[model samples]
Target: MASAALIESSLSGIPVKRGKVRDVYDFGDRLLFVATDRISAFDWILSPGIPDKGRVLTQISRFWFERFESVSNHLLSMNPADVPLPDDADLEALSGRCMVVRKTEVIPFECVVRGYLSGSGWKDYLATGAVCGIDLLEGLQQSDQLPEPLFTPATKAETGHDENVSFQTMSDAIGQELAEKLRDLSIQIYQQGSEYAQQRGIILADTKFEFGILDGEPILIDEVLTPDSSRFWPADRYQPGGAQLSLDKQFVRDWLETTTWDKNSPPPPLPEEIVSKTREKYFEAYKMLTGKECTW
Candidate 1:
């Protein structure tokens, strides 16, 4: 369970909106998004928390926000000190783990683009030879890079996992003009992110991005390119025939796979050793991908 003090301290003076792992606060026209020390697997929040997980995620997202600033407009504001934080806010202690961002009305879709076939895409491919209604090239192996990336948008689900929707479906929901713009921006961000990660010995297998409309224009909101939002694979260890080694939460997922716990049931508490190792993996990814220290 999350600590009451931690929750209250973080969400003070803001209307709390609870997600699986993050506690969001509405701060008038802006929002205070706090990454909690919670870990979730199989859509369930695990009992044991991963140390420094929040800071690592925050740092990675900030790094990508900076890297992609030239290409798109993101929700981040550069001057943290100028922003109005609570008087007793522990800003220094929460460095690199939180963001004070301009709040906009979020879109109803989750923008997903895949450069490679894997995970849910692979599952869909084996079932129907298509992913999110996009037909795949024949004989494409698992983890094989596509000839070109595809924009497969999905409708955001309210109570469960996001349901993959076709481009046509997206057009029906948000109209052809806005849908096309979202697709273009999604591919641009993914291309920049994949290229940058490739230089850092990591292959960004795929990633999800969220966008919101501000003053009648689309702006990128929420975190970008973090392990929680994207899948990271070691470039050298990536193999097509088997599961690729991940630099993210693979350790926890793998451990859970070996247990008898049903996926529908709440996951068992992770052991202390597993928690420590997972935290180290997050830290390692931050250092390797960003080329900066995990200060927290």
Candidate 2:
């Protein structure tokens, strides 16, 4: 495995916006998304990202986009060369980790779907017997599967954690019609993804989806079903009593919790063991889901 991580991408003279994990370059009608190997936990981008992490994310999104090609999305081409770039741009570094997509007027809320009781949902259930205004059944334990998936949207944040909001809150912010459409779409996709993962011995617990307006219609935007946006657990080791083994950055976050460094300050660099294990988990997910080796 390559130990070096591409934390950022350089496209001189091109207008670019860098997110925590992706570098998006602006074109008049299209955008170029480069998934750098940068990893973040607790709102902090940690040092020395897991190698080939970007490739795993990009490929996984590509796999799903192709599977659901009938669904409206922003993906145009996975090849970075399809987009215009500076003559001196490093296309080699961008290969297998970038997508050229149509630009749209982005919606401000994250369309989140939860099929399992975990994370903030667990916290909310423990406190209120509900998650985001939707009452859940009593006696549900952490990591327990819900009777059905819930569409819990959140206000998008540029720098920190996204604030979870109720479906009614989302309906109030956007029109009721649009909010309902997004909710239905999110749950449908989540069901398809969760079922597919189960067949592969993996559990797609929950995930976030982004949408944007294009030609007066909502189309899926940004990465889809990637580890960075979803919680994936091994099916064989599944347990509803507590947290299950995850294939995402939660492993890195677990290691950070054992450290003395405060999250408000700059996080400590990940040790070699953590980096290697995290990288392996990502690659393993790619292989299991797509049934192909991650050559990158």
Where model 1 places Cα greater than 4 Å from the true spot, the runs are 1-9, 78-93
What's the TM-score of each model vs. the native? 0.91, 0.98
Task: Spell out the clash pairs found in candidate 2.
Answer: none
| Per-residue lDDT of model 2, residues 1-296, tens digit only | 48479999999998999999999999888999999999999998998988889989999999999887767999999888887788999878898999999999999999999999999899999999999889987899999999999999999988898999888889998899999999999998889989999999899999999999999899998999988999999999998999889998878988999999889999999999999999999998898899999897
The per-prediction tally of clashing pairs is 0, 0
Give the root-mean-square deviation of each candidate in angstroms. 2.9, 1.0
Model 2 accuracy (lDDT, Cα): 0.91
Tens-place lDDT digits, model 1, residues 1-296: 31211322263575778776667777678776777667777778787777668777777877887878665554565334545766777765455457778878789999998988888898999899998788877788888888888888888765467888888988998889999999999999999889989999999888889898888888888878887877889898888865688878867888999999998977788887887777778888899898887766
* Candidate 2: regions farther than 4 A off: none
- Model 1: worst 10 consecutive residues (lDDT sum): 1-10
